[model samples]
Target: MPIHYSIEIADAAAHLFAIELTIDTPDPKGQILELPVWIPGSYLIREFARNIVQIAAFSKQKTIPIEKLSKSSWRIAPTTGPLTIRYEVYAFDLSVRGAYLDQTRAFFNGTSVFLAAKGFETLPCSVQIKADSFSAMSKQWQVATGLCAAAVNDNGFGHYTAQNYDELIDCPVEISDFSKIEFEACGVPHQMVISGRHHADMERLAHDLRLICEYQIRLFGEPAPFNRYVFMTMAVGDGYGGLEHRNSTALICKRTDLPEIGSEQQSDGYRQFLGLCSHEYFHSWNVKRIKPAAYAPYDLQQENYSRLLWAFEGITSYYDDLSLLRCGLITFEQYLHLLAQTATAVERGYGRKRQSLEESSFDTWVKYYRQDENTPNEVVSYYTKGALVALCLDLHIRAETQNQKSLDDVMRALWNQFGRHFDTLGQGIKEHEWETIAQAVTGLDLTAFFDMALRSTTDLPLSNLLEKIGVQSQLRLASNPTDKGGWQDNPVPSACTWGVRTADDPQGVKLTHVLRHGAACAAGLAAGDVVIAINGLKASASQFASLASNAKSGQCYQVHAFRRDELMQFELVARDAIADTWGFCKSKDSCQVNKEMLATFLRN
Candidate 1:
């Protein structure tokens, strides 16, 4: 008597697709069919269900007319017993979270699929997907889901059963010759399936991932809640993101981003890949388990608002690289470098001047996902500021308790208190609940910390906190090499200094801005100027970087630029670069304190 549904898809064209659904129910009387308005991980994404077209209903293998029940709901006429519902979804967009259908292949997120039973949210359900027969695919084309039982077939169909709607939504299926690597961590089976051309050291990747898993488990003082863990990496031609689930994570990254074993040790591409891994891994604890109260019982129809996204995403960001350090995947110096980079990015963002972390977290739907030119001016990223806020809070806790407790203690306490009880309640901890837990763990009132750091634009006391850990963060005016009108800090020969903020723009080598007092600025230039030629040779940003990679400081050159609809010429004098002049620091004292704090933080 369990609810069951099956889908049959027809690959009609390269950019067109069709799917039919058959559903079985005990009583179809007064039954209502509904499509989820939005999917988790992606907030404010509405109209996803509207892509479903040409919907038809059938009963006993006979065609029946379906009645429009509501905006996102439909009803079958004279629903007396079981019925079969069929629909066509337009899958033209090749996005990870949306349905994509083309001559090449097709992909789908369960939110695009509608469930005919409205009140049966808690009921058990099963799904069967009919694949394309032309492709010589096997059952090895794995199906990933939190669903209890799944069955595969040779006729291009995969069958899966879920305990409820939540379970169904968490499973994402990809059909391809995915590169899968399996290992064990903390006595649990771990699998990483990467689709696309992965050109990395597989053995090293698996080994490092295992260490990360083991470290996370030990930090929690218990094994992961799930018996199996899967990392579904979708390496498309050009994609960049990931979404976390209970037992799996859906990642969309560029195929070229998978670094080879001996690629540049400090390449941006490699750093980004590491950051992505850390981000998703941290989510296993933060977003998947220690969730926001609003997300506990998710309402797929609308935005689930919470003022604690800083804790969810920002705190997760703080821990991502720290987890890397804990697992020995990155050294303490490397970890500091990453933090310094994040600090520089946050400081450069003008949006931080306008938006508070709490406001940014609440308005994630309207701001973060839908970024535009004004975004840099109006919205601050909760991820950036939230991480800083977490850093500040961790330092505050450590300082107050004489390095006896830190943010790790707060996370463990949350896990012990709410994470252990989430299964029974089916929701996440409330915002206020965090305050109570913080107090319980730190024995200190966090009202000021939350109000100023999280809810307001109070500048973080990063210097004092970092000093306790033996690091120093200071900001000083330096030469701006990219700027046309700024002073350039010239260094002696044999030393190197390159200062320029370059990005790919339709216009040639677009110089976004010249650093104040930088070589380019001191030579006479301004922001919005495009560098057409360097040293009498036409070049782009990439080409210029390649040429300058070997150039030494105190180098002189003739630079040509287009400024304000006019061609201009200037002489440039290169300067010594101060790379770490933008953010707060941690001195030797602070480093020692932090090391001690880390020990205590991880101990209990």
Candidate 2:
């Protein structure tokens, strides 16, 4: 007999909604029920089960009391025959990861559903959802799941079955006014269901997505791994982000984020939106399938630590925008400009001060996702610097092998060894396993690269890497005044600076490390010194830039500062700003090397 489960969503009132689940099964001794501690793609340990308010269970019309087994699992007493279980999940928050209920709508992630069975953890189960009639106002309520035998009902409910927990967690369902657009990319059926107020040029978006898929396939020299793909978008107000999955992705974005075609400024926004799309799309290979061992069989209850996020997220980030360029969606200049912006942002943050890339990856839960004012001063972004690291490593590989091998080789080797070969039973790729793969692919030791580049804060030779790819990394000083009227400066010499990087704390303008003898440092200021005033005016992070803009070379003024809780004053002198620092250079040789390495790398 088929194991059966059902869900019903009822509109109780505005600011409140009700969800009910019913399940039927015969065996109880071997049954195990659990709620996922975290969702994939988003690497944080959030106990979603804590949100459950009231629960009840019944067997053969007799009431059964449920017992808590663990933080995320529960147990039901032994039953003689077929058992029926029911419960209600609370929905009160409106965030992307949480369940939210309101007068207008209700959103939930599947882990909220309670299960009861004998060895339920191992038993194959089926779910049938019963939607309220009012749900018809949504136009259509669709389910995005990996479960088998799924069907939709006229009452707005859908039915699906999961072979196991892995399949169950992979699927996410949405009930709303969703527009479903289907097309084929690289011979794979691709579907996009956009909900919540999507007003962009759907046709153009669809065409662009098709091209993106084709480009990715060409990169790997094969069709995508999934037979079908889904892009499910949840639109709220002003939010923008997404999480990737094996066969589908969930996107949370603002309706206004979609840009109109044929408009100049809107084109930039469109490119950004597409960049997000490409980022998640590339995950189909780089992350979703070819995952690090730590993430292979994810532990939802706590952090899954890995140092290779730079490889997973950073490399994917580099390609997200590059995919746009390769598909002729963006210009080379635009690509470089985007890189420059990313580089400058990476150079300005204080996060780099407290965390290295590997540490940043390992501590993403505490540092990256949870950001504060000191973030700029204390934490480095794995996404930004991680991409740069990928570029550096790719160039290093190319330069060492005379353009015969590159980072792409590492990616394909991963796909072949871990992704294609591994089954659900073998879910992760170990750290040393990646090292072994890299050594085999490149015929060289990657220990130094992993140690120095991935683990250590050794300055990346970005210019050399860019030059190898026929791109110049240009770093120019700002001679022009910023809107705030400060001589835009970086804290490091030959570094790009915007004059002020501030923390939200009232530690009162501590001069965090002035870039190796920058304007602030050259004027005899050291890091850890708090600026009390700029040119005799009380200053904040925002105000310092304005003061710097109005000043000229050889301008001297009394600068008050506090260091180690002691107030001190110094005479500061400003110097004329330098215009450009040639950061990277590339010739025909480097370009050819880059192309050849890329080709070989993708070919495995």
Candidate 3:
């Protein structure tokens, strides 16, 4: 018999969800049920069980003893008949990874509420949502999710079914007075369910998303894996994140980042939103189905380590914005602008020289998720550097094979071998298997390239590879902190820099990061120091930049800062900013072969 669940918004105003789980054939001995401590896609142990405000078990309407075995597990004494586990979850986390509820809306991931009956996780399951629990707003509220509807009402209140616990939790549920826009890609129905407030141009969004979806679909070839897909989003004043699922993804973004109605020009924020959408959608094939061996059977209780996240996340990152250019949503110049910014971001970080991509992937739990002020100096992002690695690999394959086979071929081969039959075969790519697959697909041995990119901290040969495709590249000094790399004609550098980032503080200018070997580091200034004065002149966040800019080349400035209630004084000498920003442009010395290759690389 199928395990069943029914969840109701117990108190919308208090952000409570009351759920009941029924097991028809629970183990005769003590049965243990567990709530996953973490959710997949996002590499963080969130300890979802802490949100359980209250819980109890019963058999035949009589309260039964339930022993708390661990933080997230419970053992119910032997029950004669069917067992029922009831719990109330406090769901106020507003991000896509957790649960949230208010009078305005309610959202939840299965990991936050559903309990998996040990040894029976592979059994079929069903869930019923009590959408009418909120009498005042029940009429307008509707449900949106990827779960197969078993007996849902017109407003999407009722029952949903899943083949197993994994399938059930992989799909998140969103209920609110949301605006939905429907579109189709490759004959598969797709919908975007948006919560919160926004004046988004639905038609334009549908048009652009359709193009992106079609391109990605065609990339992996005909029969798409999912029958339908959903983009469930919550818009706020300022937010940005997304977590992928099999047939849908939950997203949060600033309302202003959405395309405005009747606006013809694309804003940078809107482009970023579109890029985020592309990134998660691409995961439907890459990370969602294309499994890393460590993730194939995810141990939701603890950390799952892999040395190949660079391949999954990095390759997806490389393709996210590139899809915008290939789909005609952005121009070639705009694409180059985005690429240069990514390269510059990696170049500016001192940690890239200290941490290898493999180490970064392995330590994602401790380093990537729990970042502090010294993050830039101690850690390298697998997303950015990994994308650069993917870029190098792509160019290398193209160059060696004379454009006969590309990274596209390698992805297709992975899909056919590992991802396509994943549901049935339950297999994943081994740690070193990607190299083997790439070699087989392109008929090129890339062991040296992989070793250098993953195991060593050596910078990628990006400029050289980009030049072969007729794109001239150069590194330049940034004029300001907000200056991300792009083509600039005779860009002027800042007069001087402290090599530190700062934010406005009520008391003074708060230092955020002190780059290694910078003036701040030399002067013994650390992150979290609040600078009160510079050369005896009162320093504020606004005035700090101008004061640093006006410093003489050889003059030292007296700096007064507060380091945790202790006033410290130091002498600082400003120096020229580093040339770490990258700029790119079409090469004037392009030959016919180079032009052909460039055309193929950026093919629409």
lDDT of 1 by residue, 1-604 (tens): 2566665445537343455554566344655777778777777767766777678877777877778876788777765456777777776655657666544344566777646477777877787766544243344454444445566664235667777777777776655556778899989988787766667666666777788788877777676878788777777787898777777777777777776677545455555666777777777778777788899888876788988888888888887777777776676666676776667667655567678988898899989888753465568878877888888888889889887778889999988877766767656888778878898899998898888887777667776776666665655333233321111234222333434566676656876655554566688866677888888888677776655545567778788888888999988777755543343333434345567765554333
Worst 10 residues of 1 by lDDT: 483-492
Q: What does candidate 2's lDDT look like per residue over 351-424, in tens digits?
A: 56557888988888887887654466677888988888777777788778887787777777777777665555
Cα TM-score per model: 0.81, 0.81, 0.98
**Residue ranges of candidate 1 with Cα displaced over 4 Å:** 15-18, 26-29, 69-71, 102-106, 114-116, 131-146, 153-157, 259-268, 476-595, 598-604
lDDT of 3 at 268: 96
Error of 3 at 589 (Å): 2.7
Candidate 3 residue-wise lDDT, 171-253, digit = tens: 99999999999999999999999999999998998999999999999999978899999999999999999999999999999
Off by over 4 Å in 2: 1-3, 12-32, 101-106, 112-118, 133-149, 153-156, 261-266, 424-427, 478-544, 552-604
How much does each candidate deviate from the true structure in C-alpha RMSD? Answer: 6.0, 5.5, 1.1
Model 3 RMSD in Å is 1.1
Predicted structure 1: lDDT: 0.69
